[model samples]
Each structure stands twice: as C-alpha cells, then as structure tokens.
Target chain A: MSTAHTPDRPEDGRDDDPQDRAPEHGHAPGHDQDDRAGYKTDADAGSVDERDEADAPAVDPAAENAEGGEPAARVELPEEQQGEQEIPTFDLTLQIRRYNPEVSDEVHWDEFKLTMYGTDRVLDALHKVKWEIDGSLSFRRSCAHGVCGSDAMRINGQNRLACKVLLKDLDLSKPVTVEPIKGLPCEKDLIVDMEPFFQSYREIMPFLVAGGNEPTMERYQSQEDRARFDDTTKCILCAACTSSCPVFWTDGQYFGPAAIVNAHRFIFDSRDDAGDLRLEILNDKEGVWRCRTTFNCTEACPRGIQVTKAIAEVKNAILSRSM
Target chain B: MSTPLKASISVPRSKDLEVNGVKYNRSSSRRNNFEMYAWLFMRLSGVVLLVLVFVHLWVNLVSPEGGVEAVDFAFVAGKWASPFWQVFDMLLLWLAMLHGTNGLRVIIDDYAERDRTRFWLKVFLFTTSAFVILLGTLVIFTFEPCPAGADPALLASFCAAG
Candidate 1:
C-alpha cells in the first residue's frame, strides 16, 4: 500500500521553490502583451508604459548560486513568464471509502480537502491526497493517462476510470464519493481483487484460435471483417463493466460482461475457426442466458463497447448453432 | 494517545477471495440444449400468453352482457361445452403455468446461493405447477355441465333445458 513519493512538476522550466521564482504579473509573457499593446493608441500610452515597466525582469545572484553554478535563468524570462499564469484552482473534497481488514473489520469513509486545478482529474485529486496528505491512502493507477485501465472505480455512484473523469465534469458542489467497484473483494482502499474477474475472462479463451496451418505471410482480413469485432477489441481488462452488473454481484458463476465482450472479439473474427467452441462455452447454464440485458455493463464500459448488444449477438449465435 | 499498531498482519490474497461463500468455478457445461430450449420457450410462450390471456380476459370480463357479473358457473359450463373453448382454456392453462414455472426456476437458480435450497425450490415449483396443470386439464375436458339425479336447485338452469 506504500506509494513512492514522486512529485509531479510542470514540463516547462519552472522552479518548484516559490522564493527562487519571480513575482507574478497577471498577463502572459512578451507574445501576449505585444498582441494586446497592438490594440492601444496614444490615449493609452501612459498605461502601456506602466505595464512595460512591470514586465521588466530582475535577477538574483543568490538564486543563481543555489541553482548549481548555472547562470541566472530567471533574468531571461519575460517577468510575466517567470510566474506562470495562475491556473484557476478550486478547493475539492473527496470522500473515499477505506477498508483494511488488518486494522479493522469495519470500513470507514475518509475525507480530504485539496486545492485542485480546473483541468485536474479525479486521479489528480487522489494523487494530491496520497502524495501530500497521506501516503497510506492507496489506490491502483498506472499510466496516469486512461490507457492502462488500472484505476477504474466507482466515482459518485458510477463506474469510471479515475484518470478519464475531469473534476470539473463532476458536481464539485458536493463531495465526490470514491468507492471500490461493487461485487469485487476489496483488498484495500480503492483496490478490488481482480482475479475472479480475470478468471472469467480467461475461461472464455480470449485469444483467436484458427485450426488451419499458420499463414506464410500475415493473415490478411478485409476491413469490413475487422470492423465487426473492432468495438470489443478496445477492452483493457478493466473490471468496470463486469463489476457494475447486478447479475454479477449476485451470481458469481456467471461469466461477466467483460469476458463475454472479449469472447465476442475473437468469436466474430473471420480468420478464427474456433467460433463453435466459444459459442458452446457460452451456451452453459450460467452463460448468456443469465444476462438480464440490464445495460449496466454497457453504461459502465469505459471503452464505450455496446456490451448488451454483444451479449445478444452471442445469444443469437448460440441459438443458431444449436437449434 | 494513539494505540500501538500490530507488528504483523495477515492480508488475504486475491485468489483466496470467495464469491457467494464459494470460490468461483464455472458451472460444468451440461452439453445439452435444455437451457437453450427453455430460454426460447420463454420468449415464444411469452408472446402467445399475451394474446391468450388478453382474449380470455375480454371474453370473461368484457364481452359478457353483465361483464364480470354475467360470468357464473352456468356461463363457464356453457363455454366449456364447446370444444373450441375447451382447447383454448387448456392451452392457456398449460402455457401460463409452464412459463411461470420456468421463470421462477431461473429466479431460484439466480438468487439461491445454496444448491440444496435451489433444488428444493424448483422441486416445490414443479410439483405445484404439475398439480395445477393436471387438475386444470381434467376439469377442462371431463367437466360435465349436468349430472344425473343432481338436486334441481343446485343445478344451473341450462342443465334443465337439456
């Protein structure tokens, strides 16, 4: 549960230490001020000159020495650039459900207040808490961008990737409730045991199985054929869709939506020859028949796959093959 | 003052997690088309039941001169006197009961966590369904509107006309 303390810094050459940085001037550096000054005439001459004086840069020798023998780079930046434009920040409150059986069998909600930027996501808010407030506030996240699919959780009662949901998009007027996805065993705060979900995925035989000899060159498929299963191919193995299912929450034996979606990916592929076997696997007592077509999986999918439709298609495929 | 933390703690691994009090194992494939037929039967019977149920309701409740009040023992006896009405009622009784039994069986399988519980529930469901279906079929076909030497006051007026 321990996270490495890696402070995120802006990619621009800006110093983290406030004292080493220059004072703030409201406007952008030289480029933006020049564009604004172009609209002014002789009547605004005095105000323009006053603004120019405020833009003048001052270098500190002590700051230069502290920067490890490098010249004072602060003097080179237009005074406006020295201090970046104030990213409009607002106070955000996150109420996270914390569970650790080792400490206590009872799960409790922990609240955190953070100053987050308008562009910051729920993942950023969590990072601020984990990095600055409490290092023990654990959650799974890799590739802070949305691709890794590591940080799917229930944000304010809906399943979503923490990295993909912007703070501004949420109703920040209320405290955002962050809980582990439902129907999975919670290992710790915001982390669910994904093994059962993955087991269902593995049961479906996710990879393509073609019976013929391997193609000498790449197995070419028409674009039309590729497009058939293309929507399901975007699955990153995030359990968001499966955990949201009401049936999955109750009937654990059922192969969940993600597994069926993964099965759909390979089942419809024109090149794969094992469609019959996969259909047989899904035609069990706990298979597509168990799906109530609730559309919860469709709504919860971060990859935007039409999960209910895919399950229906599989049902049709099974019926056609058997009956 | 803060309490001292435990020196060591045991956390269960993800693989050790049990769902619904049992470790997740896919149910053994029955390798039969029973569930497929059952599923299809639900859909097909559902459509047929919609028509059968509405028509039955209209004939009994809406079409009669006094509506529901006009429906009495004599009315039912008169309707069952015809073979067409007999067959229609039989179809309604069988399809509705089977449809309901199958639906309840699926629900029991879904909600019942224990195998014994599911088994007993389905057993109860099938037994009751069979009883009703058998009794209903017998009543529909073998029912006689009039019997010999029945009390004149107890008999419906239509029986006296015959």
Candidate 2:
C-alpha cells in the first residue's frame, strides 16, 4: 500500500496559475536548496540518517537518475521493480531538508525507512522513525486525526498531512519520500519558518470590526451571514495552502492563500466596518496583488478550504472599493 | 561510553518556555496586552521606517556622482570608520528585520494550527534572523579587506594616494 493521497480538486475557487505573476522584489533564490536561509546542508549525505538500526530501509531521498549530481526524484515503480526488499515489511524511503548555520548550503536531504501496512498513514511511520529509530527526526503534527492542521509536509510531490494520508492510498510499490512544504523557510529536518506566513495573516487583520455604532448587546450576525464566511474560517492556520504556493516560495513577502482567506472572512462579513482600511494594508508592496493563483494551496489544504474562491472574494472587495 | 561527543545543538522546538518539566504558563492579561503592543508597533515602526527609508535613500541616492560614483570599496570603508553610518546601518538592519519578522509573527499566529508547529517554526525564524542580524553587524564594523596584506595594489585609493 502507498501512503500518498492525491488531493481531490472538485473545482473550488483555487487559482490555476501559480506562475502568472512576476515577483516585484526580484528576490531570486537559487533552486539549489542549499542556499536557503543561510543553512549549511550537505549535498552529498542523504538527509535522513536513522539513528536506530531497525527493520527500516535507508529511504531518505530516493536515488537520483544521474542528472548533474542533483538527487533524482524517485519515480513510482511499475509494480515489477518493487517489493524487492526481503525485509519482513515495506521500505518507504524519506528525504527531509537539513540545515546547520556554521556550514555552507543550508539545505540537504536525509533518508529513513519504516516497516508498514499498505494502509498505514505517512504520519504513523514518522512517529515510528522518531521514536524507535531517530529521536532527532522532526516534523510537526498534532490532533493526529487531522483536525488541528499540523503535520503539513510534502509527501512525494504534493503537500499533505502525514496523519491524514494512508500509504495504501498511494502507489506503495515505490519508495515514498517527504519534505517540508515549499515556499517557506526550512528550519531543519522537515520544518520551515512560519513567522513570515503569520505576518501576512495578521496584516489582513482577521477579526471583526463593529462599525462606529456601539450597540448594547453582542453583535448579531445572521446564520446566512455567518455561513458566508464559514468555509473561509475553516482554516486551521496550517500553512499547507500557503507553502504549497510556489509564489510564496520565491518571495517570502507575499500574503499567500491563508492570508487572503482570512481577509475574505472579514471582507464578506456583514459586520466588518473597516473593509477599506484592511484593503489598504493588503495594497502595500507585499499584498494580495502578488498572488499568481497557483492551485497548489487549494490542492494541499487538508481542510478542503476553497482557497482560490476566498482569494477572489478579496480581489472583488478591493475592486469594488477602488471603483 | 560509546556515545559520540558531538556538540549538542539545542533547537528550542517551540520556544514555548518549559520550566521544571512544564510548559510556560501565560496570563490572559499578557496575551490581550500583546495585541495592543503589536498594534502600537505596526504604527510606530511604520512611522519610523518611513523616516529611515527616506533618509537612507537621500544618503545613497540623492548624493554626488549621481550617488553611485561616490560609493566604492573605500567609500564603504570610510563610512564604517565613523560611528554615525555604523549606527545608521545598524538601526536599519535591526528595525527592518524586527519589523518584517514581527509582521511574520502575526501572520503565523493567524495560521499554523498546532502549538508545536508554531513554537518550533518561530524558534527557527527567530534564531535565524537574530543570527543573521548579529553577523551582519559584526561584518559592518569589523570588516577588514586589507588586513596588513602583502598585496598593496588592493589597498584603499586613499592609502595609495597618500
């Protein structure tokens, strides 16, 4: 069984063009991964090193297909070249980003192996590796049931919750590797810095503004009014939607999916009195205009939030106000 | 006896204070006040940055030789030789990093669901930014391109002329 779960795209409001907008800041990042955030990453050593010599296979990053020494992405085995390992269980490999500042090239890949059922989730195997094999193998997860919006990482070529995805869901005959969500800072071992992500969120002021009128009782919002902003509110703040965004990956300044989603929550709210002010904040150099509409965030959001639809709502608000 | 003695790197995973085996408890008062202060910061820093940014532009862009010609390796050397430019650059670096990072901190709070992710990611962001700022300040002050080197040709134009 494979652990990868292809995200369902039923046509919400997600942007289809992640590469449409040009980055205004001219922040060119060398795709070398090593040049990221000034971390010294070993281009040679496989990122994942299992401290525990267990039944796990050495599946950090899969073998490169010999393209200029860059690690080759592992292709799904065609059922014939798989299950060759005679170990009692499976060998799903993982490749994670690692960084040490005092060194050069702050990005590199590490690998690890874990025995599993075809139906096992990527998160289960990670727990096993962290507990039994490598104590230092780090990734973020909480509410293992997927409610809390943690454990957002890139499995194979997509962003997902290690807890929510089942190995059986993917083509498990081949090794499955994991990395931190793209478009953000990789702190170390499958983690990325989120302060920039949060800055965008807070910049939108994801809150209620009771217009200048001060009523006696609490602000009353009709259920339909509330429901208008409800789906947007489903954001657990997991950056899966944002990091899956390639535009965010290049420029750390973009407001991103979740930020616009939060803005939608207020912009469409009947109670918010300061739509113009909020829009002004987003109009700055690194505002909503930077979004190139990559559906990656919608595809990666585990909560099934309609990321692009929400972004559209924000744009509509801005346009309506400017007119 | 078999354990390797590598320098233990302590990455405070969530930066959530842990004292005596318990997570640091926060008072509601502080959280409410934190928002107030954050609001204050955005306004104040926005104002200060306006001044700093324009002043910075004036110094570099509105100067002689259309500004570019006046700036050279020796120009940089001369600027840092005084305490004024050092302080100015230092302020710009710190304020920019802090303003940008604080902006990020707010965004993160608006997203990142799990406490662990928030804690660890912030720890990473804070540490990295702090480290860069610290290193940048050091370089700005102590940079010595010609440290009594044998290559006199590369010496400052002023030194050669004198």
Candidate 3:
C-alpha cells in the first residue's frame, strides 16, 4: 500500500473531496492489489495493506462513519519538506556608514535592527532595511548574486560582496558594520564614483587588438593557450581588488590590480598581436610597477582570481621585453 | 505626495576627483628604462646584501672571541689593514646606501602627493645619500687606525709595537 502513494500529485487542492481517494492514490476504482503491484501481488499484498492502514492518520470514528469512508490520508512529511516548518530567524543589527553630501557635510553611522532568517545574506539584510524599515538607505546592487559584481562593499573593514556574504558566517554577536569600498569618492551612502576605476581600465586597452583582418569565422586557440588566461577572464570589474589595495588608496593614478588583471587576460591570449603596445602602456611609472604585491587584491577578489600573480607576470613581461 | 528633494551638493566624477587635496593626475611614462633597472637593482642588491651583511656581522661580532665585547679599535684596524677588507666594506656601504635610497625614493613617489613635496623630499634623500656614500668611501680608504700623535694607550696594540 506504500507503493499506492505515487510521488506525482496535483499541487492545487482540487482533489480534496473525500470520495476522490481512489484516483488520489494513483489507483482506478475497483483496481485490486493484484492489478496495482503487477509482480508479487499474491504474497505481499496483505502486509502492504496492513502497513498502509497503520500509517494512516488516526481518524475520529464518528466523523469516519458519518462520512461513510476513511478521511483523506494525511501523509506525515519530513521536517524540512513540511510547508509550515519553523525557519530559524534572529534579530540582526546593521551599522551602516551614512554619507550624503546633500543632507550635510558630516558623515554618520546609522543603525538598523531587522529580523532576518539564518539563510539570509548581508544583501538580504540591507534589502530588508531598504524595503521595510527605511527606503532612504541607498546602495548599488544587481543580479543579487555574486556574478554581477555590483554589490561589492566593505564588511567589517574587509572588501566583500554583500550578496555573497551570508549572515550566519559573520560574527553576529556584534553589530555588522557595512561601509563603502575605500580609495574612491563616496557620492552618497555605499555608492562611490566608479569612473576612475573604469578610466584606468580603459588606459590598459582591455580588448583584443589584432592587426590583420578580422577572422571570418572565429580565432582558433589551443586549450593550453586558453587555459593560460582563464583565471583573469573571470573579472567582473568589481573594483574590490583595486579598492582594497594600499597603493591605490594613496595614488589613484596607479593602474590597480583590476586593470592589470584585464590586461593579463589579453596579454597571454596567444592571438592578440598588440602585446608590445600593452606592455609599453603598462610600462608607465603609474602602471604595473606600482603594485606592491600586498596580496590584498588576491584576498578581496570575489571571483578568486590570482591578482598579485598576474601583476607579477606583467612585471616580468615588461622586464623581459625591455631587457 | 511629498516633492523629491533636490541635491544641494554634487561630487565630481572619479576621473576628476581629488584625493588628499591632490588632483588625480597619473605621471606620463618617461619612455626610459630607469625604473625597471632600479627595481632589478633592488632585488639583486637585496640578495647580495644578505650575504655581505651577514658575513660582515659574523666577522666583527659573532665570530670574535668575546662576541660584541671583543670588537675594539685594534680589531677594526686589523680588518681595514687588508685591501680585500677595504674593498668589501666599500661595496657593502655603496650597495646598502643605494638600496635604502631607492626604497625611500619609491616610498616618496608613492606617498608624497604634491609635486613640489615629492621633488624636495627626493632631493633631500639624494643629497643625504650622496653625502653618506662619499663620506663612507673616504673613511674606508683614508682611515688612520694608528695615528702617530695619539695616546699609545688609546691606540691599537699594533701601534705601540710600531
């Protein structure tokens, strides 16, 4: 009888009639165990029927007799699958650094207390505050996942993606501090001017520059050559690696790790012919040489790109080409 | 409905932004290989200094009979008496000074924001480094370990013998 309950069931509650039990259990009217099992119907049918009776929910005799049939079987669902499962939730406090030049010249910290679920991320908490508590809370985010790279911010002094950082992983005993990524102008709360980061990106010529005619079909590349630049291709221009840099914090002119990583992508592509021009561009004083190899960029990259290693490779390329 | 508030202030785009009162101007490339050579020199000299400095320390301090206490006027005089020792000390002095100066030069370039401030700081650094290097070279070659007019007790034991 346990086999009577097929996994397929109409999600809508249309089959709730007490008389509709036959089709509800995947059986036609008058279909016996022999017809249903199709194999060992003679030997095991009685035991299956007994177990099915025992597993059925306890029903009031009066209600059953009054209705002239057993009530719909209420199958006990697992704890996690139950629609009414109690999700663990807790009160989360977010201390956000608020800066609005229009409001005032002074920067202040705003605290927001929100009830959030265990599975909720820092981005969820921010959304809760924005949607429910205060609509004035401002920040930039897209895709709501790690891919778009739009929600990169500082969580407790380290650069991280808000959407990627789950609330449970953070130290919830204290207020989670959320602030804007440093070394860029903070236009408002959590939003910074991204033009400088993109300017540096533009300086490196972050595109394929082939001298010959464009390929008719596609430029063919070996697997090994593709694999060489595969790591840097994951960059979403998040600027997390660049802002976390101490050198970039001082000098905005420095190409920063993101630009160099983008350059590394095309530099080792094996098809691009403008490697020399790129090398000359990055050979500037404010170029790859400014990278102090602090490993901050490596730690801050949400995409897990090896930023310092790429910068070092560029430096090595410059050295080899020059010498 | 409440009217939207107009922004009383505006921030310049990042390319035109100022950090620490200095405009964001990337110094154009000089089209020279000076920085590359300086960077290479730091790495090479760092490795060489590791050997040179440790050997110098071991000979003067750790290898002596009484460690640091064994170092005196006579010990220094004995070491400088040899041409090989003179050349070794000279090389150490030059490399170390230049290495330190270049490291500081990079730091000044990194930190000092204003053009005039960077210029003055680098000028001061170069002048001081040049003075020390020149003075150190002169002392290594022209050091009179056993001056004739000095008190015999203050001089090295070899001076009394002479």
Top candidate on lDDT is: 3
Model 3 lDDT, full chain set:
0.74
Model 1, span A1-323: residue lDDT tens: 00011122222443552322221322221111122123333345456435534533432222222212211121111222234465456887899999987899899999998888644678889988999998988899986655568999999999998876667567778899999998878889999888778888877777766655667778899999999988788778889999998878875778899989999999999988767777877887778888988899877776667789999999999998876
Judged by DockQ cut-offs, is candidate 3 incorrect, acceptable, medium or high? Answer: incorrect
Best first by TM-score, ranked: 3, 1, 2
Q: What tens digits encode model 2's per-residue C-alpha lDDT throughout A1-323? A: 11111112112221331211111111111112212112212331122111111212432121121112222223332222122332124566655566644475556776776667433468878888889887877777766655566788888888887776656455556667788887665667777767667766765767666545567777788999988878787677888888887656644545688888888878788877656666665554445655556677767776667788777677666656655
Report how far residue B11 has shifted in candidate 1, in Å. 31
For model 1, give the TM-score of chain B.
0.82
Worst 10 residues of 3 chain A by lDDT: A28-37
Model 3: clashing residue pairs?
none
lDDT by residue for model 3 (B39-69), tens? 8999999999999999999999899899999
Q: Which stretches of candidate 1 lie over 4 Å from their true place?
A: A1-85, B1-22, B148-158
Candidate whose DockQ is highest: 1
Interface RMSD of each: 17.2, 21.9, 14.5
lDDT of 3 at A256: 90
DockQ of each: 0.15, 0.01, 0.14
Q: Count the backbone clashes (under 3 Å) in each candidate.
A: 0, 36, 0
TM (B chain), model 3: 0.82
Question: What is the C-alpha lDDT profile of model 3 across A121-192, one tens digit per residue?
Answer: 788899988899889889999866565789999998999988767675667778999999998888899999
